[model samples]
Target: MGKFWGKFLRSTAVICLLIIFAVNYRFEMKKTIDRFKKQSDENYYAMEKDVSAVNELLNILETSGNMYYKKNSNIGNHNFDFRYRSKDDIYVSTDDSHRLIAGVNKISSNWAVKKELDMSEILSESYKNISKVMPDIAYMYYASKEGFVNIYPEISKDSYPFLRNIYRLDFVKKELFGKGNKKEEGVSWSDVYKDPLGDELLITAGAPIYDSNTLKGMITLSLKSNFFIKKIDNNLITDFFIVDQKGNVISQMSHGNEEVTSFYDRLPKKLYDKRYKFSDMKPCDIEKIGKYYVYYEQCNSAPWRVYYVTDMVKLNAELLRGNVVFISIWLISLVFLYGASRRKAVVEDSQQTIEKLQVMLRKSDREVEKDFLTGAYNRKGFTKIASSELDRMRRYDLDACVIMMDIDHFKKFNDTYGHACGDFVLKSFVRTVVKNVRLSDIVGRWGGEEFLVLLPETDYKGALLAAEKIRKMVEREVFYYHKQSLKITVTLGVATLNVRKTLEKSVEEADEAMYSGKETGRNRVVGYQDIMSKDIKWKK
Candidate 1:
């Protein structure tokens, strides 16, 4: 009877100890879980907003293109001065010397150049006023397959050859243009990149321009790559960061000391590989990998999984710091009597380490400065060196001229035959100019049916002579096609830049002369000097 009574007392004591273990640890677990839940929720909404902002930037670009298509047709030239550049838009150009004023808004036979002014205006406004729409947007750009990259909040050419480098990224080809991605996910975060200007990492989210299922180009916006990792608090989450799908840790310092970075290396493959187990819209998951207690959740905005990890042994020691006697009694009760261990303390790490994911993107081949079809300089390539050539002319007090040419009624050919025949005629026209002109003269496709010729060391008369020769040759050449032998004529405008003036003013004068020829007969050569005849005249 006495032995049964002793056994009953010991049984009651064991039940009380079990209750204490569940209560103490469960409270700690709940606190950590709740904290992680709140942080993840905040990050999810922020990421959604950022990705949405990038998508909106594409809309702005397309809207501007549509606006250009609807511009006033009667206006001979769409002159948008860059000096009156809006406060909101950043001025980005291949030629920094001409950055102060726009010199190339000239109307051509094609709609391509005319709309650049409208795009520049609207893009600036989008960047300036979008502060109200999405205040966190610091960088955004539209990268056209036509070889132009328009970025807001001007980037440095020395620091970042943005136009050349941006086109060569894998993200631009695959992710933005939709090869490996589902259509429902309209925009997606790119693998992070090291910012050229700073130590920080950046990520891109953008959409591509598709015309009836044909990809035209892409537009993108950028934000910090640590969007998810920033949610980790050093005091609360000592070993917290984000990892890519491959389990590479993207560690960035979140206003903490630099010493913290070297503390933890890459995250284990065992953890990130198990990311699928943490279901979306579910509770924060708690897992033990080796000696570490890991809490994790998936990010909705970026292609990353966020994690909070701490050493289990260290956490228990810290938790038992204040409850020394209670923990002692609890440990003794469990180990000596019950043959169980006390609930290990649920606590954070003693020191914090942010693991940064350094994404090394291979520089794609950047051989796009020249025109792909015609082999002449495209506008982008021409603009890169045109300014320096003119500056040299000015420094030497030598004569130089720019000739603007356009094929008269070129669209009728595209309408009559298919676009293929029209493309053939353009190639032939370029061939004739390159064949006849001096080796020093530069030829470039200005836009649509419009083309440009740079005459170095030439007066208006010399340029006119050269322009007339090209005009006569183009008038004579026969485009022998299988369907029909087609004939075309070109109008030429010449402007002399011996007098001091901006390139835009000279190009504007040249464009004006070209339009005059188009207005009169369409096969003649006109000189800006002969028309303007002001203080600036034809210099020999």
Candidate 2:
């Protein structure tokens, strides 16, 4: 007997250990699924915000380009190109208009001032348009091939003299005369460069200006690097940055040093050695980099990528906490199970009783709520269910409609056939309607031959469509009683809920319309508005 008991104890301990392992595995799986869900949501919202910002900036650029185009069309024939003259006649050698305007340069200094004023007015308009959208624009200026810069609004007398040769700036040489700018007709962004005036890092957006087919000049909008950083820095809990195609850091949400130029340089040696380029990174791709997990997304409007980096230390800690708790629970359960093995029969009996009581309670609740024959909600249950649904719709400011329907001449059919046949028809009709409506919609027996359907988030137009579909479906359904084919049709009325009325009032409106449909045509759907209009038309 002692040997038999020892074998039994070994078997029970093994089974309990397996149960603990299964529980721990299931818990960990659930946690992993939840973590991924949260990560996906975070990535989606982050991408959406940055994409919207880029799109808005693109729109501002397009608007600025159109302004320049209009100015060119209005003033191209004026021949005022010689406003800025050089001893070398550099512009004149390239542009024929420069020669034409230079021939007439002896006119007057007043005419030259007028031409400058006209150009300044055009620049001012462009500045106003862009500044209104992006108030933090660093500078709005036009750079001409003649090495002239027209800074808008008001350029200080000290800076105006120095800015005249801005065409020599690296931004113009790299962005305007660069390889990508030659073929692309759209706006182009320059890599971050130090502002000569303030020594702050800034980026430029350049839109090319053309004279018929000749490249003339460009309208440039400059913005400080902090424009991108400030918008996102304070909101982020983890490290986030924007990087160029070459893995050069364009802007970071919160970097201690503005001097950190490349994203790859900041990475741990192990990660940098992997040679992961920014251009190759896909949207929402997460990669393990040393002790960190990095997520990146490609911008739709810019040739840049956004990255979010999370430290794996915190994640490991959370996993450790979960495992520790799971082990502690397993240890406690092991001891409890060993002690309870002697009274397993009594415990099993109690568990069975609890389950039986739960089953009875569920059946009792179901019986109270459900219709005996149709499997739909009864009047009391439907009122409770539909009112809750209506409350949710109102809370969310969503559109919803209630459809009231009745079988045409249902009482007459019941009298002709037996009660059992009538019951069969009701069940079949409800079943067909249930299958036709959306899963979100609710069907309930509103007593006798009438039924009510609550369609959440459906507008008046959608509800009308739904009611028409049900009307046609009911007309087509062929019910069979005994060996003979039976026919039945339903009239429906739809009323959409609005701020002006309550849910009950909407249902009353549908009920009235349903009666109206029966009075006019036995197999049709009528909206509450239709009945109201017909009544008014009859009175007239």
Candidate 3:
């Protein structure tokens, strides 16, 4: 009976202690949530103001943009040369125009060029006129369905490459007004996107021009991503993000030096995909997703959603340490400090997870063309990019060359050493090739132990010199496989792309020339045109 009584008392004490802990946890969580919600209210107001300001600014640009098209549609000649062509065929007239920079995806008739250039000039004048009055807009542009794009705000002589990048932007190709959805009526907004040539983040408001029910082009106004970010971000408060309909970030607050990427990757899929239905209502809060307290507002004006995320881990413990909540303040403070340290660790791990998501995001698109092992272009990617560049070379009457090289006795490395050593050799070989090539040049792994190199503005002689230099460097470099040392040589075939031949034909020619080198001598450079010099007969 004495033992039974003792056991019962101890059991009762343990159960009472657990109940106390449960109550404390509940109280603390409620207090933290209440405080977080209040802060979110302030954040929502600030962000709303920011969005409104952006809309207002866009409205002014829309007015200016409309005026450009409102003017005469008739073509006017200002003696802009139709005979002029840029080297890459990516740019048209950049240096000549002081206030307007022009680029084209491909050249068209002189009549079309005159028409595009004339409209571009009018747009440039409108941008210039507006700047004198309202110095608010950073830049304005017009993108035609044909290929022409005029970016106002004069690009310098050497900065023409930047203009070309703008012309080749994905938005220019597909979503001129963020037209992925094509939801809005006029002056639709582009999903926030980063500049391919630089670090600057930008979003565009574009108004499409229609000619009797046929879609023409768009007049776009550019705004920095910060124009939206600066409004709601407070380091002491919640983190903010402007997410598009597709869960792409339009703008975001600084989260240290870590780059902000796809928002869908950061949160649970259902948050944007399913869970709560977003309506054209007031800013609303989502109680919790995982550990984050989220609130969002769908902009009635724009097709994007604004999010405020409150990390429960970062919440202050002032409420838990208050006189009403705690009898021993310092003791509670010590416990809170300990908990905060653990939460910091959780936050660090979360950041590492986010970094991994960034890699996953890149894999979805960019990696489709990328080689998994070597980071070089795979066959498909190589074919696409090389074909484009080759077409440009042929059309613009510029010079380029192709080099098809294969490892001499590459099978020996795999058979004798092992596939691991073979892979190491292949990786090392690619490194050497890439290091020897110019930044403008492209290298691709056509297949196992065989690679393709595209050199822009390179003649046959230059291509041969480059190939020999690559061969000599590769021959001299030592390879390591554990204790054993190995060296390898490459047989390269050179072919010029300036001729009126397709990319496939040129690649075939280069491949044949490489085979000729293998037939004649194992480790030598050979040119397709000089196949007659060798005994091997190459089919034209």
**Model 2: per-residue Cα lDDT over 1-540, one tens digit each:** 997898798678869798878887677644533453245335435544544464565556545544555554442233334433344332211232211112112223354333433443354455666677676677776665544455544443244334534555666886456644344456667666666545566667776655334454566777777666554422112567777655667677557435538887766576678655544554546666666666665453455667766655555554444455455556666657556653222123445544643443342222135664587876656778877876776687777789999998887667888776888889989999998999988898886789999888888889999999998998998988776688889999999876557878998999999998999977999999888888899999
Return model 2's CA RMSD, one decimal.
21.3
- C-alpha positional error of residue 190 in candidate 3 after TM-score superposition, expressed in Å: 2.8
- Which should have the higher TM-score, number 1 or number 2? 2
Question: Local distance difference test, per candidate?
Answer: 0.60, 0.64, 0.66
* Whole-model lDDT, model 2: 0.64
Which residue pairs clash within candidate 1?
89-124, 249-357, 250-356, 250-357, 251-355, 251-356, 251-357
Clash count, candidate 1:
7
RMSD of each: 30.6, 21.3, 23.1
The alpha-carbon deviation from the true structure for residue 86 of candidate 3, after best TM-score superposition, in angstroms, is 3.8
* TM-scores of the candidates in the order shown: 0.43, 0.45, 0.45
For residues 1-540, write the lDDT of model 3, one tens digit per residue: 997887787667656655775687678667556655555555555655555555565565445444544655665464454333466456555246546545556546566456555665665666776555434456677777666667767655456556656656666666543444333335466666675435667776666654334444667777766666555644334577777755677676654213436775555564556344444223344556655667665454566777777765565443433223232433444445334554211112445544643543342222136564576886757888987886787678898899999999998989998887888888899999999989999999887689999999999999999999999999999987776999999999999886587788889999999998999987999999897554455442
Candidate 2 runs further than 4 Å off: 1-120, 126-129, 152-169, 178-184, 230-237, 276-281, 317-540
lDDT (C-alpha) at residue 375 in model 1:
68
Q: Work out how many backbone clashes candidate 2 has.
A: 0
**Clash totals, every prediction:** 7, 0, 0
For candidate 1, write residues 1-540 as lDDT tens digits: 997888787788888898998898767555444443444434434544555456566666655544444563442243443332233233333334212212212123345443444444445556556545654554666665544555666654444333445656667766544463333325555666655444566666766654334443455676655544444443334466655544545444343322223213544565555554443322246666665566654553455666666655555554455345556667776566644555554333332211110111121222223554576886655665678787787788887889999998898889988777888888889999999999998898866678888888887778899999999999998888665999999999998765477667778889999998889899999998777664355542
Q: By the lDDT metric, which is better: model 1 or model 2? A: 2
Lowest lDDT sum, 10 consecutive residues, model 2, at 96-105
